[model samples]
Target chain A: MSSDAELIGRSLRGDTSAFVEVIRRHETAIGNYLARRVGRQAAEDVLGDVWVAAYESRATYDRSYPEARPWLYGVALNRLRRHWRSEPAEQPAPDLTRLAHDWDPWPAVDARVDVQAPLRRALARLKPEEREVLGLVAWEDLTVAEAGRVLDIPAGTARRLLHQARKALREAPEVAALLQVPTT
Target chain B: MDEMDLMKKLSDVPSPSPEAYDRARAVLETAVAEPVDTVVRPKRWFSWPRAGVAAVGAAAVAATVVMGVTGGSAPTGTSTEAASPVVESPLVKLASEVKAAAAQPGDSSLVIATKTAPDNSRHVYYTLYTDKGQIFTGDSTTLASSVTRNDDQATPYNAKVMAAAREAANGDVEKARIAMITAANNALGVGLDPAAADKAWADTQAEVAETFRKLGKEVPAPRPRPTGKELENRINNHLWSNATYALVVGAANTEVRAGVLKLLATIKEVTVGETDLDGQRVLTITASPDILGGNASAVLTLNADNGLPIRDEVFPAKDSPQPSKHAVVSYESSRVSLADVAAGKI
Candidate 1:
């Protein structure tokens, strides 16, 4: 049986179905990634575009790396950039209504951590690119290097950006206090 | 929350509304759609009575001759007459001229702005430029990839090379076939069925070339000319091969065809004609679609001598409800030049 990597290789050769398989495999992760960056409403609008773009551009995909997720992320990131460009510069504060719209906590583990509102406020203060790196880490669970691949930046540069962004947030007194808070 | 905790929370975020899934699904459906086949395949090309399986090649060659001879004599039917010598309708003429320019020796480039209606819903515009050997595209996607092949030569667009090659074939018929073959083998991003793609490319090129030559134009020297009936046989082979592939790949689904055509219809047809703009021999083309409703046409001015498209005036369809009623979506040069593109001149 050809591994996922082999199937990707087939797709590169002209088997579009192989590429389609890749999408079917990773769409959930990609959906989650977009939902985090652009939120649910716009995320849904842009996700299909991301998949289509990825499918259309499958020829340029660098297959040395087996997992197609990073490349798919790159496509999703580009769509997000265009979407951001079309929207107004001063984005509205991420309110509870917005957060609740996209996310709901798992009631059994930990209820009522309303800290997301404050986090969103702080996130709004960051540069768009900075927010991207932060979201990839804190939302997408991407390693710095993987995120770098997705962003089409060098791993070292991604690490540096992550370090700077982390330091800035860690030093923010409110975030620092939140960091210190022990969960039950 | 720690970064990991936050990351987990972000990943698990729920969609805000039910409509999100529907919208995403629509894009996915559009993404999977294909063009060309959507226009019911006329029992054969334009539905000329089917030539025998063995004589299809000879038949296509004969058809080309008949078409050429019949050009002036055939009673004017649906073919739109040239607007006027003074009024100057040059879109088809420019398309031919550009095809000729692409054929000349040294590397040449031109930019084309394409819009397609995947369905009746919306029209998407993409500005694409190509050096005779490579193409650079910008539109819905950010990466500059090949419309032909996935090879290293493809650069930003290695992924969709095969599809691009097929599209090129549909556009110019001759040139696109050659380029598509090159893409099938060399394009890097995806694995192409090289044997099938290569055979298809070679056969289609020869068949189209023969058709063109029989119509009385000089056979522009192909790299390695295949034999006479070889062209005919190849085209037939290709059609059957493609048909087989489509059938096996399941291209019969009507929704897929309808969706793709609907998308293609959204792109207004652009017709370029020779004219004077700023003291230059410019080809001015107007883009419009019948159904998009009111002023969905854009007038573009290109350098006629060199076939470079420069300026664009986008007007709302006469029925447009949008505010900028009849306005121009502009460009910087007569043709989309690669040098200018590299400098972000667009």
Candidate 2:
């Protein structure tokens, strides 16, 4: 199979089928990324625009990069920013905990304690840029350097942001308590 | 929680549903089917000053609308022989309207169109055309206040359409129709192959089938090779569809609008009627059913006063999926000067 870069090259040459293949490869991850930032409903709405935008700008894709995920994330982030700016002011914040419904960290005996709530709050409290870098590295499984490319920032900047986010979470009272607990 | 656990939780979201993926793919397919020029350029963040200038220019043009600098030729009824109750062909009536509208002078034309998708989401576009070959466009999210150039091409598609319309504006309707057809074919990248027309069509069918297989779509059964008048009709229909598309998307030029109306009139099955669109008397042109196969019908509504198109709608066959789903695009147009647009004076 051709790499994403190769497929993008084909797309620039007018082969849209190749671009469709690229979308198929990354839609799941990109969709999840959008859902994490906005809610799932909004993510679905923006997904198509992102794909179309990416296809249009495929000519600008850096062929040196073997994978197109980071570039696609960059496009998705831009779309998300526009969506955020255009959203009505009265809209409520997205509930990040929606993703954790399938897995409960606390068992029956400890169910009374909601361990995930503080983590969600801390995640929300981080600076927007910091959260983005950290999420790309952690949730998206991209390297710090890769996240930097997505944000169009220096790798050192991305690394520092990730470090600051981690340090803040470590110091949070709720997160500290959870870390101190024993784990199997 | 530890970083690993935190990461795992963050990544635990459910994947997009299959329906979502399908809808997104369909959007992509529609976008790709059109000319590649529709690709959107990524916006630069530090362009506020430029945007401000454009906004000022647009405001100037809006203010000038009251001055009547954006005037155009009014639609005139076609000449009729004395005591003849013979009804004019729909094409002839529409052609006459286009000619009358083309007679009115304007420096530029503005067009606003909205496209509604199967999901019911609407994408609105605003376009402006200057006689000197500059095109400006915006959308509902970003109105005409911050219009951008249509493209880097010196002679954009709109200008080309306008030039062709002007060429055909001469009184000879038959000659004008031929010119419009040639222009539409050129725009659509459809070439004439007199010597090997039959073989060329056969090869085209094979290529289409191959493309379908590559895209994982079912290969559709190929019809018998057309010959003589059937082949001629097929070719003309293909060109007609292309011309109609160009007209819908880029008919801001008065002459181009006139040319399109004339070209559409040439199609025997296209019927013209009078109706009210938004309280304004308008001429409606409805394409014959099955003109483009699948029993689809395309209807174009034009402003009866100046022969400008107000809407273009396509209704798919009933048996097809989502029979109620129709593609509708509504248009709004004006005339302005290129110099004013460039100087931030509107």
Candidate 3:
């Protein structure tokens, strides 16, 4: 399969199908990225926008990175920040914990009793940067360096932020209890 | 549970519907279908299609370094210039002459823009267009990058004007006129009557607002369409710019060139002046201040014999929004076969 950079290079020429291929490869990952930040409902709405923004700026994408998932995560995060700031007070934005419980693809995970509230509270307590790096690494399955790239921060900073977040999660009374609770 | 396990358990957001992805893809394709050809616009950036910003007085010096200037033209008056023998109109006579002349010898149109400013840096553009409307553009003077349309050199502007040019070539001046202007600004193709104009204005405002909305930015209030003389001036301004682009881009094609001349002949606001440069005669086509909304005016210089566009300029008036940003862009066109272009031979 052609790399995302190769697809983008094809797009800069007149062939738009190459770009559609790039989107096909990453849309689900990007859709989930938005879903995790905004609720699933809002994420679906914003998914198209993230794709458009990514498509418009694809010319500037660095070809060195073999994977576009990290770059796409960065684009998704920027759109997410804008979505957060622009969302109105009365409008709907379900919490990730609620969204997770509402619909889980995995039968075992869906059947498992929800212990997300304590972790959510603990995650909320961390600094925004720490939470961002932690979520990217733990939730998005990115390496520390990849998370740093997504956040536009250094690998060292992302590692430190991840460490701080993990330590805080360990110390939080609510999260510590959830960790002690047996997983079926 | 470990931190990774704990986070994984929390992040099971439902997948978006396939329809959602399809909607986004359509928006991108809409943008792609238009002239995203080298134009990098941010979400909120609303570039007025009619408003032209290019070179004027100082651009002559730059033109001299590149194309070699002889006698210069201020291009102030529209009424007095002989592009050819005394006929009903100078432009009409020139158009007839060009139409009669053989099309430039090339399977494709080779349009070059060699720009030099005060910085002493040199940049050249070679844009080659097939009669079929495929475009190959690159910065190499040798046309080194003008390979296949699937190559990185392929772009999307000449195709927009190709059909319009073909129409003009076929002698449907009115249809070509509409096509040229509308291609420049899609909204203008609609009627500018009170009801039609209002609807077009509303559509434009909505599109601009949607762009901002998509970027998650505050939507700006739409400006009301201008009334009375203000609307006429704006219309003329766009008409002039539209005609100018069609004329310049399609200069290599005999029918497109003659068709643009016929289209320009209809616009009362557009005036022609003939002048000599380096003993070679050329025509200075001017759109005066009255035609433009503000004091700003624009001029396009053309080769008198064959009607090839040489230099185009915008002299921004006192009330112009961007005086410092004005530029002087010149053109030099030649003929080359597609076979040679594909081979990277100039």
Candidate 4:
């Protein structure tokens, strides 16, 4: 099977089907990324939007990095930002309110860490763009450079934002305490 | 915890309902399958007679202007008392009303008249209402026409013209009705033109029906009607009618909304404000995104009077700015609720 980079190269060379392959590979990850920011419902709309947009602007896809996952994440992030801004200010904030609702991990690892409340509090305090950068890195497991690529920013800038975001999170009493407890 | 673990939480965030992907994919495929003519070429369709009349009116206004310039007897059309609120510029008045409408919600009503100069173009009056349940009752110039959701789908009635248009394999009448309905249903009622779209849809339908009819005997079985969201999306999105473009742009359906949201993400900021057209108040929302080569802003404006979208203007953006690119969108209603019709309410 061709790697994602090879598929992207094929897509840029006019193979639209190859692009679909790219979408199929990352659609779930993109969907999860959006759902984390906006709730599940809005996330669906956002996910489709990201796909359509990425497909439409595929001509500008920089082939330097054949793996399009970071690029796709970037497109999805921009869409998420726009959706948030278009909404009336009074509407519910981004679903980053991650309060650890009824979520159970398979294999039942009982880490009774109520880290969600503090995480939510810290997230709310960060600038909108900062939260985006931090969330992409931490939650999406994107490296600083990958996070930067997703946000259309320089990798160094992304690293700075991540560092600043961590500093801020650490300063928060709730989040600081949670950070002290090691993850099993 | 370290950043990696925190980031891992993002994986836990559930994906959106699968239906949304279905809807979005359907919308994008529709958008992709149908080519949208976003070039807003200026339309000069005024009839010769209307042009002559406008010339005369312009001459009279000009004469008054010259007289005022020369400090002549207070100018002919200038009655200070008449120039008061009663004679305020329709656009300005509409702007105020639009501002008011933006603040309120749930079952509001307004009536506004609009004009498209180069008078050959149709002029329509849209009256729109949003019920407490968010069910919108929308109608246009003629009272017999209106549109509302019936059976979770938009149905038109007293709709001989619409039915005939449909039977004729031209979806113009319904398209026109929906354009108007979309305009009327919006909080900032904007007008739309379904003529070009109707023509295109009609042509496609006729072509399809003709092809099927020609193949009738040769094929062992007739083609079945398209069913399910996938097929519906295929057909609906395939219709490259101009009106469909406006409809998709103006209305907030699941597919269209997804497309619009995607478009918005590529941009930096939007310029949304109030304006007026032909004595109707309108709230205009324009966006100048980083996309589009930074050439132009896609402007969507709605008339506040009846909560219908009246216009969509794609003009030059900050770079190479000019009002050269323009297209007019207008709509008419085909059906209304029984309660509204009984009350003689549009």
Q: Which pairs of residues collide in candidate 2?
A: B73-B104, B91-B265, B108-B335, B110-B333, B110-B334
Q: How does model 4 fare in lDDT?
A: 0.42
lDDT of 3: 0.59
Give DockQ per model, in order. 0.18, 0.20, 0.21, 0.15
Q: Which stretches of candidate 4 lie over 4 Å from their true place?
A: A3-14, A88-115, A181-184, B1-11, B35-346
TM-score of chain A of 1: 0.76
**RMSD to native for every prediction?**
16.4, 13.5, 15.8, 24.0
TM-score of 3: 0.51
Best by lDDT: 3
Q: How accurate is candidate 2 locally (lDDT)?
A: 0.57
Model 1 regions more than 4 Å off: A1-16, A38-42, A57-65, A81-121, A181-184, B1-12, B15-27, B36-105, B108-281, B287-295, B311-314, B320-346
Question: Worst 10-residue stretch by lDDT in candidate 2 chain A?
Answer: A100-109
* Least well predicted 10-residue stretch by lDDT in candidate 4 chain B: B67-76
C-alpha lDDT of residue B95 in model 3: 83
Q: Which 10 consecutive positions of candidate 3 chain B have the poorest summed lDDT?
A: B64-73
Question: Can you write out model 2's per-residue Cα lDDT over B68-122, one digit (the tens) per residue?
Answer: 1111111111111001121365545655665654344557665667665433345
Return model 3's CA RMSD, one decimal: 15.8
Flag regions of model 3 displaced more than 4 Å. Answer: A1-184, B1-88, B117-120, B149-160, B192-197, B289-295, B319-326
Please, what are the lDDT tens digits per residue for candidate 4 over residues B163-268? 2212212223233332322221111111213343334334433433443344231222322323333222222121212222322222322222222222222222
The CAPRI-style docking tier of model 4 reads incorrect
The predicted structure with the larger TM-score, 3 or 4, is 3
Q: What is the Cα-based lDDT of residue B336 in candidate 3? A: 77
